[model samples]
Structure formats: C-alpha cells, structure tokens
Target: MEKKVQQYYRLKQKQKDIEKELAELRQDILNYCSEQETNETEIGRYKVKLVVQNRKEYDDAKLYETLSDPEVWRLLSKSDPAKVASLTKLNVISEDKIMHTYALKTVTLLQVDKK
Candidate 1:
C-alpha cells in the first residue's frame, strides 16, 4: 500500500525473474561441460567453469549416539524452552538449575503478501 512496499515488491519480482534465468543458464552450462568432458567452457577469453565439490556433512544424532558422552551431548544439544517448561511442570527438572540458561531476544521481520 505504501511507496516503499510497492518498490520492494517490484524489485523482488525482477529478482525472481533474474534468478530463474540464471538457474536455466547454469543448467545449460553444466550440461555442456558434462558433454565435453571438461570442467570449463570458454567464451572468447572468459571461462564459465563447473566446479564439483564433495562436502562433508556429519549426522548429529548418529554422532551423538556413537559418542555417548555426557559432555559432548551437553555441548551439542540445545534446550527447547517449551519442552523444558513442560518437564519443569512435571517436576523432572528444577527451575533453579535452568534459570540462567534462557536468554531474551528481540527480532523484527518483513513479510510480503499478495492480494
């Protein structure tokens, strides 16, 4: 409804269009590189390269299970406030023990809606 909001939506639409075009071009480049059995393609002096990387990602739950160390679990795990509150109500955990664990935070967000 406002000028800034109108500009934001307009720019976002252009961004989505550009991103879609880029993705299509990237797929074409990747396909060309694969077909040529080369990692790069040259346009005059400029090169469009396809980089393949093997990234290492460890499963947190599996690693935690395998290690089975209380210290490790303490370091890796995060306390869910709702779960903690429910457990606290049942007398499973004390309020005093978890008193300083919670932190207060403020967050602001913008959401765009289509009408």
Candidate 2:
C-alpha cells in the first residue's frame, strides 16, 4: 500500500476508537448536566453544551402543490448540486439558468487523493 493509504487506514481506525470513547464520554457529560438541571456546563477549558437544534425538511410534492410557483419549487425542493454541476459540465443545462436554485450553494468535500 502507498503511504497515504497507510496513513488513512491508521487514522480511520483511530477515528472509530475515538468515536466509541466519545459516545461514552458524551453520555457521562449529558447525565451530569441533566442531574445538575442545565443544558450546558463547564469542564476545564471546554464549555460543554447539549444544544437542541431545529431542522425542517420540506416535502417537494406537497410544497409545489401548495405554492404553485416554479421558482418557489426550485428553491424549496430537494436537489443535488453535484448532479447539477455534472449536467452543466455535460452541456445539458446552462449555468445562468440555475441562479435561483438553493441547491447551487457552494460546497467542499474531503477525500483521499488518487495516486
């Protein structure tokens, strides 16, 4: 195996072990915070928090039906930006036409480099 592959495999294994230990530590912290009647607590330099985030998922069919606007549907409906970019690269769609697309937001991904 190449050096990068070996490094990735080692880090991936460490990540799994860290995740397991993290879950256990998370539970312990949560239990302590709950018993103390608070959603946040300070431990050493880390201000641990059990934050509740609100996330909304809209259904495409129902949203389009109620709104009846093509522009609204484009923004609200679920889509894959990578697919949009792929189609654009293949000359299937114009970049100017997708300005209203909410899924056209910038994104970045991390992966192992190809040898």
Candidate 3:
C-alpha cells in the first residue's frame, strides 16, 4: 500500500510539471502571434528582431538583403545547422491574415521547456 501511494504521488508531481511546461509553451505561442500582429505604423522607427529557428531548408541568409530593400519585404532568415535542421523565413503579412498558406511550410513546434 505504501509503495503504491509513493508511485501515485510521483505520478502526480510529474503531471504537474508537464502541465506547467505546457502552459509556458502556450504563452510563448501567444506572445509570438501577438508580436506578429502588431501594427507596422505603431512600431515607430525601431527595428524588430526575430530569432527564427530553421534556415538551411529555406536558403534564407542569402535573401536577407532583398528583404531589407524598401520595395521588398524587410525580412531575414538565418539558421544554425547544429541547433536546427533548416532556416525559417519571417514573412510579414497583414493582421487580417496570420495563417500561412497551405503551400508555405508548416510551422514546427519546439519542445516545451521544463519549469
């Protein structure tokens, strides 16, 4: 009976930890989405920095210059092969459309950090 109780308590603790981590991940996603939705006009003259994960798959580094051009989208994609498999692009769209098209690559979910 004592052993069973110990196992149950351990399981409960593990569950609590998992739940905390999940909440953290949810918050991160919310923050990212919110930032993306921020109005460009309200952003003032400051530059926004995004730490994108994944780069090699999209060949994003070479395209940074083009993105910075006024006539083009001011975006950049950088990758660290050792950490992430490929590079990710920062595609800025209007607040009305936050979802990437079916043709664009799907967003990769990262592992939730333990609290």
By lDDT, the better pick of 2 and 3 is 2
lDDT of 1: 0.58
Runs in model 3 deviating more than 4 A are: 38-115
Q: Rate the local accuracy (lDDT) of all candidates.
A: 0.58, 0.57, 0.43
lDDT of 3 by residue, 1-115 (tens): 9999999999999999999998797567647646686422122443333333442342344334333444433222342332222112333423123222112343443333322
Clashes (backbone N, CA, C under 3 Å), per candidate, total 0, 0, 7
- Per-residue lDDT of model 2, residues 1-115, tens digit only: 6999999999999999999997787677767877998766666666666665432233445434554656644653554445545655775555565544333223222121222
Question: Which lDDT value does model 3 have at 44?
Answer: 41
Worst 10 residues of 1 by lDDT: 106-115
Model 1 RMSD in angstroms: 15.5
| Global Cα RMSD, each model | 15.5, 11.7, 15.6
Worst 10 residues of 3 by lDDT: 94-103
Candidate with more favorable, higher TM-score: 1 or 3: 1
Off by over 4 Å in 2: 43-46, 79-115
Provide the lowest-lDDT 10-residue window in model 2.
Answer: 104-113
Evaluated with lDDT, which candidate comes out highest?
A: 1
